[model samples]
Target: MKPFYIDYPQEKIAEHQHAYRCLHCKIPTTIIFGLLENHAKDCAYRIHQGRWTQLEASLKPIQKHFDEPHIDEVD
Candidate 1:
């Protein structure tokens, strides 16, 4: 897991020039501190990330044995 959830899209806070927050959840960056749980449960970023992780886990290739012979394709 990432130490921080900084990858989510951010929008500048209107009142503070330098302050930013999550675009979907509107939670301040300082408050979120990179933890996904800090974002709202229905946050768009969180929802997309959940599905992305699941897809990646399911798509992982199985490990092959070292003893397996290599086959070369004919030219």
Candidate 2:
């Protein structure tokens, strides 16, 4: 999926508070070194951000290699 980037301005809200906004949904969020990703997960416009299919497609080749059996040494 394409990355959903949040806007974090250089200025702080108060002292330790930082304001964040979703570029896709235009929703305001306040956080302090917290999980900014949670906003995107609950955002209504998350679907417009990107699709998980893109990520799956990119990982298919890597996943295929990992699926192959490997010989392990026993001591």
Best of the candidates, TM-score = 1
Indicate the TM-score of model 1: 0.67
lDDT computed for candidate 1: 0.86
CA lDDT of each candidate? Answer: 0.86, 0.46
Stretches of candidate 2 above 4 Å error? Answer: 1-18, 31-45, 52-59, 62-75
What is the C-alpha lDDT profile of model 2 across 3-72, one tens digit per residue?
4344333333353355645544444554323234554565544453335545677777653345545578
Question: To one decimal, what is the Cα RMSD in angstroms of model 1 from the true structure?
Answer: 5.9
TM-score of each: 0.67, 0.29
lDDT of 1 at 11: 97
Candidate 1 local lDDT, 1-69, one digit each (tens): 455667999999999989999999999999888888888899999888878777887898988778655
lDDT of 1 at 21: 96
